[model samples]
Target: MLVEFRPHARLRGKQPADLGASVLPVVAAVSASDTDLGKVRVVCDWVQYRNNFRDVVQLRPILNGDLEIAVDVRRAADAPVGELTSALLRQSPDRVYLEDWRPGRDSCVWRFNALYWSALDLWEKATGRGYEQALPGGESDARNRAAAAELIGELFAVWDRLAASAALPDELYVIELGVGNGGQAKVFLDEFRDLDRHRGTAYYSRLRYLMCDYSAHVLDLARETVAEHTERVSSFVLDATRPRTSLGFLRYKAFLVYISNVYDNLPTDEVAQLGGRTYCVHNRACLPGEEAAELAESVSATVDELPALVHKLLRLGPVLLAEACPDHFADTDAAVRFWQDTWAALRLAERYVPLAGLDTYPLTDTLTGEALRPLLESGADVRMHVSNGAVASFVDTLGLLHPFGKLVCHDIFVDDIQGYRTTFRGPGKYDGSVVNWVNGPLLAHVGRKRGFDVDYAPFRHRAGGHVVTMTAQVRD
Candidate 1:
């Protein structure tokens, strides 16, 4: 059977006027008997669902936690939440609508690591257009294209000051991370060339514009796109989270580090405050081959195996595939294709497990766990971005800048934690990648800790966009 439910009347469309009260009978009936199946279906953009109940089932919107409720089904009023959840999940393949939680450890959203390491190439390969075409406002331009232009205007102001002061090196450097299609790089280089010519500053001749990204394929394309500025342009394939490793040669030398919509794409873990307690959100990833486009149940993973499998695939995708089939090692591209398909079909089941404290938060392995404690604030119930990757990336990039240098970035940012609790911030899909609202306030707080001034303001040239320009520099 299929059912439709709403959390509230005014939220979006229509459900029953008394939907919440009306669905109690249906839920209680299913919980009492095993023959009747009680499944959950999330009616949100992040997930898609199909069953006979679409027009048949009547559900009241029991919108509580993402993976916490099974139409509020429980054995009794006092049944424990974890036990109830485990029991509900064991009831065959029932539909469970989850908002922000996940099922277990190591079950990441998958879209992000997949994109950065492999699917990024698939983005242009699968589609003739570049990945940027997936931008909401359409075409290769970001919906915030106006803001990109605004970013350039501000860059010039910073540059003019640096040039006049003469404290910066003669080899003035402007490094842009995540240079999509080299459009911004092209525009920036072209503008700098002209600006130098007009001002007779000779800045263009001495300019070293370095473009960095995770995808070598994108870098090659960007190289071709900006061929006109070959003399002053160079490109490096580097990880955004650890900029200083490849960037060591230019340490404390680059005058400006520019980024656009890059931080939001980096990996992040979501933490939530609920009923005066905190929990780490996790997801159990799967491939139900029977599902519309996903893999089948035969290939579905066990709880422990899920993380191990994802890790093995990330570390030795081709080797593992070949070990399973020795004859196909010669056809490397075919293995790549299978991996791409798997990533595309990947789906996550959410679960929110309670946590002990900040000391045990997961990002600690890759980032300073203690540094992130402040971001997990306690107040009126809310959720916030842990932006571990962004903070790690930002801190490393800051160290690479010269004394007169600064870091300029533009992306969807929540200037306050309340924005996350009240607004529709996301881990939404963009092409084959994930786009999140990087925690701006958290980044600023960390910046101040390192003796730097980090400030956020609406992109000056635009009016109505979530994009904010973040500027970070050593305190004057």
Candidate 2:
């Protein structure tokens, strides 16, 4: 078996080579070439590696058929080396195999994520609640009327100046991306109309409010919520990562593009710098062998058939999946239950593979891995999300802004390089979608390169909240 050791941010003042030598004996028993375990990876700091989410000693059936043993450096430093062997033996498996390995960007996790939104209505009915109820506070901060009013005030300030020069366009535009249940759009429109009436301005009469989201089901719900302003609102089903494809007509015309709780859900890849070498993290989705057996039996199927069934569920959704595989699923409810169960049982196996060069890494379509060296090599050892989808959307959306226009987003952001070292940034499950904190400093860097000023501040409306407000505008 091939042994790879990755020391994380929590591992301080220790060399990767030293850590590898200390744990060599602990992994020797499972390293036989003929053994069922395909590869071995020893992680020095499991807590920091997994962001303190799971409390476990080892993760089996990881990428490329690897067995991962996680060690607590502090404890291992003091205890007898044999204790590490004991923990490893306790979690060692009888046999290990999985369908395939993939990068985090190519994992089945995203398919499941899209399924959640496409079949959201059915999921809500089966679960007896909406997706928003699964959030921390059972609601999004984006719906705040006060926050809407604040943004509207800023738009008014810009419009007032433009109006003075007789340059205000005949039609005023305000675009909202990721219109979750239309709550934010309703609040903004209501505030705009009220504020416009109060100020005795005709801006409301010239307003064109556009709501965009990836889910048609979500857009339908949003339309109902904001039915009072139907004349001013228009909704589109568009991919958040490539908004320019759908809204190219509005290039350099949109005065405001607002987003909330959206960027964190986009797909991202992580890169790590270890022992003076850079590597890209690749992931494979797996269920523990025993758990796989139990789940398969629960669905009236064998463990060998789980992967194909899962792919079917993701491609056809639970309702059609029930019809497609009547042998495994009695009906839609059964398939929905299977989907939920598999998601809860889902675990990712990750490996660090050496990169040929940083330049070869594509951070996004317009940016490359060369941009990440500054952040990756800033400290001892670190792993950080590249936020590929968010960066692509940010760059494309910038094209939608007028010279004086602004883009505002509120989401989880890692504002400082130190934040990655100290906190769990995510890859956490939020409902059925994925959430990873966007790289704020990197985005600010890219925006500056494109002649725009980007700034990040804590969400002002909610004190001590995790949300950060990022605003970008053409640099004066």
Candidate 3:
């Protein structure tokens, strides 16, 4: 573990070794009576040394319970201030697993997952906005409007060609996977409507915009936002990963499947390349205090309980909530407040576990078992996203596109494998849920296997954001 001290900001210099060497300086700096807390970034890098993966454990305790530990073991670990390292050592982690797809918890804290989901539910109920909107200036959809307008213009160009050849579908479909507060959907639909009116193509009348999400609460909020175009709007409660099952009725019939900031929020597995071998890096979510630990345990007691809880909180109506938890309803408002508090207490602990082989690691849906060739097989030593949910969602969503239809997605995409090593992304808390950088190269590979032309570029609608625009179309 390399402990770097930045009393106010990060400093560059060769610091001394562990305890007395590094600890004494921090201790001396904080010896002042007025200073009670300070920050230290402890990065633990685990290199393949022996049969079992050995982590180089180093510590520079900054006033204890105030150290910022970032574990670069398996995947990049995002530890909050004041976290201790406790590895499983010999077994699978008890708390953390690869996240299952849930609309409300597309991303989750391995620790305090239950609290996180409950907090998100409480927040949506209280604010009618998602965690994305909780950030400053994150509530705006102007960039999406520009992106949507450009997309619509291109789709209309394709539509004109299709119509000239008499191949246009009577019902043109535009699907959005994660519709946050319907801000982007409203912009998209409004632009499409305006474009239709200007061109006098009557495309708006034939347009069927499907807002698919896992949370009914979220969908309800989307509906309220896009209420003006109810005539052409439809909503479905479906998993983005396995959209084929619920949206099978419209298979190969839809055009323009659009997604905004959805792929980054999906659940993904972390894989690492080391010593010419690929390994599945595993970590469990760990909370600090006993109270926070208990809250995490209560929420994730079962294997899939956290997702079930989130789904219940999101999909269940108020009357059903009253019926399900009759005892907790006496002080429903206070009960709801507790949910938000639990989410704020989440922290993560990570370690690298040597994989015997890549034989068992699940990569793509169709290409698994011995047939799977892990992307991390590259020569570089790096960790990256095995975005199972995003890939499955991309594959299944592409299946819904017509011959002329195109899939457009905007997200925080890691276009190169090298980006994972240098940049901070994934396995981190946003406001109430987890946010990860989607692996664009992996998605592009999957698209190639499926005979689709997949490409990525910087999000032209915005600058400085990590978001990349990914486009997929049927290859000739």
Model 1 error, position 270 (Å): 1.8
lDDT of each: 0.61, 0.79, 0.60
RMSD per prediction, one decimal?
A: 7.8, 5.7, 9.3
Query: In model 3, where do residues sit more than 4 Å from their true spots?
Result: 1-121, 125-130, 140-143, 290-330, 369-374
List ranges where model 2 is wrong by over 4 Å: 1-55, 59-99
What ordering of candidates by lDDT runs from best to worst? 2, 1, 3
The lowest-lDDT stretch of 10 consecutive residues in candidate 2 is 46-55
| Alpha-carbon deviation at 81 in model 3, angstroms | 11
On lDDT, the candidate that comes out on top is 2
Query: For every model in order, what is the number of clashing pairs?
Result: 19, 0, 1
What count of clashes does model 1 give?
Answer: 19
Per residue, candidate 1 scores C-alpha lDDT tens digits across 152-255 of: 55656777786678654668788989877788888777766776688677777888999998878778878998999999999999989898889989988877
| Best of the candidates, TM-score | 2
Q: Tally clashes: model 3.
A: 1
